[model samples]
Target: MAYTGEVEVGGPPDVHELTDLIITKAAVGPMDNNAYVLRCRATDEQLLIDAAAEPHTLLEVIGADGIGAVVTTHRHRDHWQALAEVVAATGARTYAGRLDAPALPVPTDVPVDDGDTISFGRIRLTARHLVGHTPGSIVLVYDDPHGHPHVFTGDCLFPGGVGNTHDDPAAFTSLLTGVTAKLFDVLPDESWVYPGHGRDTTLGDERPHLAEWRERGW
Candidate 1:
């Protein structure tokens, strides 16, 4: 409801109805990476997405009993710097792409693949592999009770920019192609996109911009 200063925490009405999916920003300025805490209301099953730099605050919001799993978006430390700390506090299982497994300090409980569905109570998180910034990058899709989908697009799709280029130029091309075909093409216009950085946008808003963006290149 009310945000004080350095910290802000609240769950909207719909969020509470399905799961305690709270979005928190880490930086003081524009480039803040977004992290989420999803807690199932009925079963109290909790999962975290990206740890960022504020694990202590993230822990305070989700607490101990609720968290069961954590799914990292990529291998970038900024998106997952405090993962080990939070995992230690909550004893939650960690899931990441197999390519990112070696970089993580803890062993991954689940190596996510494209099209894999992770369920908790009424919520279902579907993994869509989009490898541009990282070979194993993924965007998660969760459908609300009303059937409206919310995409947690890590570094893949930002408000106005896609993710940065990888070591291999082919990887970047593949990433953009996958996102355009798998994400932009398939998802409905009304679907919400919660990117890793900046504010939220919709498929409707992004669709028109895609042609121009593609011409200019990532």
Candidate 2:
């Protein structure tokens, strides 16, 4: 309900908040990776997802209130470019999918497994491990007060199509299958999708495109 001035770093982010979650999103690094700061309104505790580039600016956005933990979306370089610095500065607990844990610059404090639950404030996020994007690609989900769910899907799903499989058909199939079943089939049309890069979209906007994404074999 309360709006504040933009937390400008790369540029002013498109902010979104409903009920307990306040999302501060910004583009960072060479890839223009999206890094998000998710704050729990009641507890004032934060969980940072994909601590991409621009360490100083990311820390500046964090400001006085420190983060509770830093969750790496995947082992990709662009995603965690600033993970070490941000975690070192905030001393926030670091989490990565167990399979991708060893590849990170900083050792993961918590190696999350599929279906694992991450506790923060009064709610918990369920990790849906969707492989092929990486052996450990994950999407975090929890219900919002408005009835729609808020999903942080790293590079697995995007606006128009699924993430690049680097021409690997098997990976493309695996990721697409996982996304279709675990996300689209389960969540409501109103579910908000905050991806690892680019703009945000809702399930309602993307559901109709699934068949198209599949037909093209992207």
Give a tens-digit lDDT track for model 2, residues 93-157.
99999888889999999998888998777667889998888998888997776578989999999
Residue clash pairs of candidate 2: none
| Runs with alpha carbons beyond 4 Å of true place in candidate 1 | 1-31, 166-169
lDDT of 2 at 160: 95
lDDT of each: 0.73, 0.85
Off by over 4 Å in 2: 1-9
Instruction: Write one digit per residue (lDDT tens) for candidate 1, span 1-218.
Output: 43211322332211323333443333311236667777765676778888765677677767656578889988887778778898888888888877776787778899988999887655679999887788788889986756567888988987675788744567667777888898888888888887776567788888888877666677
User: Which run of 10 residues does model 1 get worst, by summed lDDT?
Assistant: 5-14
RMSD of each: 4.0, 2.5
Q: Give the candidate number with the greatest TM-score.
A: 2
